[model samples]
Target: SNLETETEKLIQIVLIGQPELDQLLKKNELRQLRQRITISWELLPLNRDETRGYIQHRINVALGKGRVQFSRSAVELIYKYSHGIPRMINVLADRSLLIAYTMNTKKITPKIVRPAVKDVGGLNPLTTWIDSLWKTILPGFLALSILLFGANYLMLPDFNKKNVEEKDLNLIIKENPIIPKNLIISNSQAPIIDLPQSGNLALEKMKPVTPSHQAYTPDDSLTTKLLNPRRIPSTKPLIIS
Candidate 1:
């Protein structure tokens, strides 16, 4: 004011400060100064995409072709917490990078940024709520998912084994039309036979059958059917003892 009064040439005065300066000048005591101000321009905060580009630009200038990078999630968190203020962005970004460095990682993520935000303090209620939500909810959800996956993985083999056993049982029943009532198929035991004495004559006429990995001694009823000297496939031979 003194300089302008002395010069009498309408000197221009520029006030550059944080947004708080606007509220400061709006106070009752500063009404005269506020009214006398010739012009006022407030710098708007950067938006989400602009904040990303700004951060990337700074990183590129500092690192050149370095491998260090910020994940999109981390950038989003930074934008949320800083509300696109450049100085706050710098603070959060720097802290996040430092946190990542301590953890021996070149990439900054929301996990790293969360801790950095806490360490820097001055978080708004919404940001704090989000931080708490992630800290508590995300881990529990992931753990549940992993547990469910593990349970499903563990149960799959048993289900497949049961199906295979059933299929094997059905195939055995289909291939051998006459199965003894006492014949039992189990994992630990092979098929058993209860032969009757009525088909001894037919058994003697039957040729000595080839051995196989799966050999079943048939009932007297099956021995009667073998009396007809028909061609049997070698792969699916009926063994009788």
Candidate 2:
């Protein structure tokens, strides 16, 4: 409950900062206490010459009277960046003093002020952001591109077959027919011995007789008499009987 009360007070304070605070206060029971406020001031930014004067005054106060010095170029840059705003002028003046002290110089130049503003505000160039993005994303994109190119190449029809050479031994054999020796012989002549159609019966049933059963005679006439023995001996035998 205490925290809620504190939160409500903070919200009231913020709401009062708005232009409608007078109308809102009429609705609240604490209007008498809120209306007791007497003085108010609305702060506004300084003009360009006033901005330069403010910076000079702050620097002179910090470094003792007539002790510190600044170039015209430095004062012009401060006016340009602060845009005649008193708050911004104070900030720039303080930073410039610090830079002058560190560098052991009495003059606050535009160069020193620029770097100090960038350092405090964390300003980054657009090109630098772009370069960082490209550095992070380019390699992956290039790798994917290479992979896509390879896929496309594989998907395409193979038209690089001009280097291929084919040899046909069957075609060569057909162009030059071979004729066997048996096929060249005429039918009127005896058939070739090596072929199946020779029809030579001597070669089909030829058998060798054993030496024990073979008839042998010294002369051709005896061989013929042995083969066909005469019947004269049979006549002599019948007479004796």
Residues 159-238 of candidate 2: C-alpha lDDT, one tens digit per residue: 67553334466786668879654454343333222233323353355354558878644465644555553433221211
Look at candidate 2 and give me any clashing residue pairs: none
Over 4 Å off in model 1, which ranges?
A: 4-13, 63-67, 125-241
| Predicted structure with the largest lDDT when compared to the true one | 1
For each candidate in the order shown, give its overall lDDT on alpha carbons: 0.80, 0.62
Give the C-alpha miss distance for residue 45 in model 1, angstroms.
3.4
TM-scores of the candidates in the order shown: 0.44, 0.36
For model 1 the TM-score comes to: 0.44
Alpha-carbon RMSD, candidate 2:
27.7
Task: Pick the TM-score winner.
Answer: 1
lDDT of 1: 0.80
